[model samples]
Target: MNRKIVEAANIAINNLLPTKSRSLYDIAYNRFKKWCAEKNVQLYSENVFLSYFSENAKNYKSSI
Candidate 1:
Protein backbone atom coordinates (compact mmCIF):
# COMPACT_ATOMS: atom_id res chain seq x y z
CA MET A 1 0.00 0.00 0.00
CA ASN A 2 1.12 3.55 -0.46
CA ARG A 3 2.86 4.80 2.70
CA LYS A 4 0.60 7.83 2.96
CA ILE A 5 -2.47 5.67 2.62
CA VAL A 6 -1.17 3.25 5.19
CA GLU A 7 -0.39 6.10 7.55
CA ALA A 8 -3.79 7.60 7.04
CA ALA A 9 -5.62 4.32 7.57
CA ASN A 10 -3.66 3.55 10.70
CA ILE A 11 -4.24 7.01 12.06
CA ALA A 12 -7.91 6.84 11.22
CA ILE A 13 -8.42 3.47 12.87
CA ASN A 14 -6.33 4.28 15.88
CA ASN A 15 -8.13 7.54 16.40
CA LEU A 16 -11.37 5.63 16.75
CA LEU A 17 -10.19 2.67 18.80
CA PRO A 18 -7.91 2.53 21.76
CA THR A 19 -5.09 -0.01 22.16
CA LYS A 20 -7.20 -2.11 24.53
CA SER A 21 -9.94 -2.48 21.94
CA ARG A 22 -7.87 -4.28 19.34
CA SER A 23 -10.19 -7.26 18.84
CA LEU A 24 -13.30 -5.16 18.26
CA TYR A 25 -11.29 -2.80 16.13
CA ASP A 26 -10.41 -5.62 13.78
CA ILE A 27 -14.10 -6.14 13.04
CA ALA A 28 -14.57 -2.43 12.48
CA TYR A 29 -11.50 -2.17 10.27
CA ASN A 30 -12.72 -5.07 8.19
CA ARG A 31 -16.11 -3.47 7.86
CA PHE A 32 -14.49 -0.20 6.86
CA LYS A 33 -12.39 -1.89 4.19
CA LYS A 34 -15.41 -3.75 2.89
CA TRP A 35 -17.46 -0.57 2.81
CA CYS A 36 -14.73 1.24 0.94
CA ALA A 37 -14.53 -1.56 -1.57
CA GLU A 38 -18.28 -1.63 -2.08
CA LYS A 39 -18.39 2.13 -2.55
CA ASN A 40 -15.31 2.33 -4.78
CA VAL A 41 -13.70 4.83 -2.46
CA GLN A 42 -10.16 5.15 -1.23
CA LEU A 43 -9.86 3.35 2.11
CA TYR A 44 -7.91 6.25 3.53
CA SER A 45 -9.99 9.08 2.21
CA GLU A 46 -11.53 11.41 4.78
CA ASN A 47 -14.57 11.89 2.59
CA VAL A 48 -14.97 8.15 2.34
CA PHE A 49 -15.02 7.88 6.10
CA LEU A 50 -17.39 10.76 6.39
CA SER A 51 -19.75 9.18 3.92
CA TYR A 52 -19.53 5.77 5.54
CA PHE A 53 -20.27 7.13 8.98
CA SER A 54 -22.99 9.33 7.66
CA GLU A 55 -24.74 6.44 6.02
CA ASN A 56 -24.14 3.86 8.71
CA ALA A 57 -24.27 5.92 11.83
CA LYS A 58 -27.86 4.97 12.52
CA ASN A 59 -27.07 1.31 12.35
CA TYR A 60 -23.88 1.79 14.32
CA LYS A 61 -25.38 4.28 16.77
CA SER A 62 -22.48 6.69 16.45
CA SER A 63 -22.69 10.26 17.70
CA ILE A 64 -20.41 11.47 14.90
Candidate 2:
Protein backbone atom coordinates (compact mmCIF):
# COMPACT_ATOMS: atom_id res chain seq x y z
CA MET A 1 0.00 0.00 0.00
CA ASN A 2 2.75 2.42 0.91
CA ARG A 3 4.69 1.54 -2.21
CA LYS A 4 1.62 2.10 -4.35
CA ILE A 5 1.00 5.45 -2.76
CA VAL A 6 4.60 6.52 -3.20
CA GLU A 7 4.62 5.37 -6.80
CA ALA A 8 1.45 7.28 -7.47
CA ALA A 9 2.97 10.34 -5.92
CA ASN A 10 6.04 9.98 -8.10
CA ILE A 11 3.93 9.67 -11.25
CA ALA A 12 1.79 12.62 -10.29
CA ILE A 13 4.84 14.71 -9.56
CA ASN A 14 6.42 13.81 -12.86
CA ASN A 15 3.32 14.45 -14.89
CA LEU A 16 2.60 17.82 -13.37
CA LEU A 17 6.10 19.24 -13.58
CA PRO A 18 7.80 21.04 -16.45
CA THR A 19 10.82 19.36 -18.01
CA LYS A 20 13.26 21.91 -16.67
CA SER A 21 11.98 21.41 -13.16
CA ARG A 22 12.05 17.63 -13.13
CA SER A 23 15.27 17.13 -11.23
CA LEU A 24 14.46 19.70 -8.59
CA TYR A 25 10.93 18.43 -8.29
CA ASP A 26 12.16 14.90 -7.81
CA ILE A 27 14.52 15.99 -5.06
CA ALA A 28 11.86 18.08 -3.35
CA TYR A 29 9.25 15.35 -3.57
CA ASN A 30 11.62 12.80 -2.07
CA ARG A 31 12.57 15.15 0.72
CA PHE A 32 8.92 15.97 1.36
CA LYS A 33 7.99 12.32 1.60
CA LYS A 34 10.91 11.60 3.90
CA TRP A 35 9.93 14.52 6.13
CA CYS A 36 6.35 13.30 6.25
CA ALA A 37 7.42 9.80 7.21
CA GLU A 38 9.77 11.05 9.91
CA LYS A 39 7.08 13.34 11.33
CA ASN A 40 4.26 10.80 11.15
CA VAL A 41 2.26 12.94 8.73
CA GLN A 42 0.04 11.78 5.90
CA LEU A 43 0.83 13.14 2.42
CA TYR A 44 -1.55 11.46 0.02
CA SER A 45 -4.08 14.21 -0.55
CA GLU A 46 -3.96 16.87 -3.28
CA ASN A 47 -3.80 19.72 -0.78
CA VAL A 48 -0.98 18.07 1.11
CA PHE A 49 0.94 17.53 -2.09
CA LEU A 50 0.47 21.11 -3.19
CA SER A 51 1.51 22.43 0.19
CA TYR A 52 4.66 20.38 0.20
CA PHE A 53 5.51 21.37 -3.35
CA SER A 54 4.88 25.01 -2.67
CA GLU A 55 7.03 25.05 0.42
CA ASN A 56 9.86 23.28 -1.32
CA ALA A 57 9.56 25.51 -4.39
CA LYS A 58 9.94 28.55 -2.16
CA ASN A 59 13.08 27.16 -0.62
CA TYR A 60 14.51 26.06 -3.94
CA LYS A 61 13.77 29.37 -5.64
CA SER A 62 15.44 31.27 -2.80
CA SER A 63 18.55 29.17 -3.07
CA ILE A 64 19.02 30.04 -6.75
Which ten-residue region of model 1 has the weakest summed lDDT?
55-64
Residue 39 displacement (Å), model 1: 0.9
Residue-wise C-alpha lDDT for candidate 1, range 1-64, written one tens digit per residue = 7999999999896788677898887998899888888878754767777888898867776457
Tens-digit lDDT string for candidate 2 (1-64): 6999999999996689789998998897788789778767764788777777787677676535
Local distance difference test values of all predictions, in order? 0.82, 0.79
Q: For this target, which candidate reaches the highest TM-score against the unseen true structure? A: 1
Candidate 2 local Cα displacement, residue 17, angstroms = 1.9
Residue 7 of model 1, lDDT score: 97
Flag regions of model 1 displaced more than 4 Å: 1-20, 62-64
Worst 10 residues of 2 by lDDT: 55-64
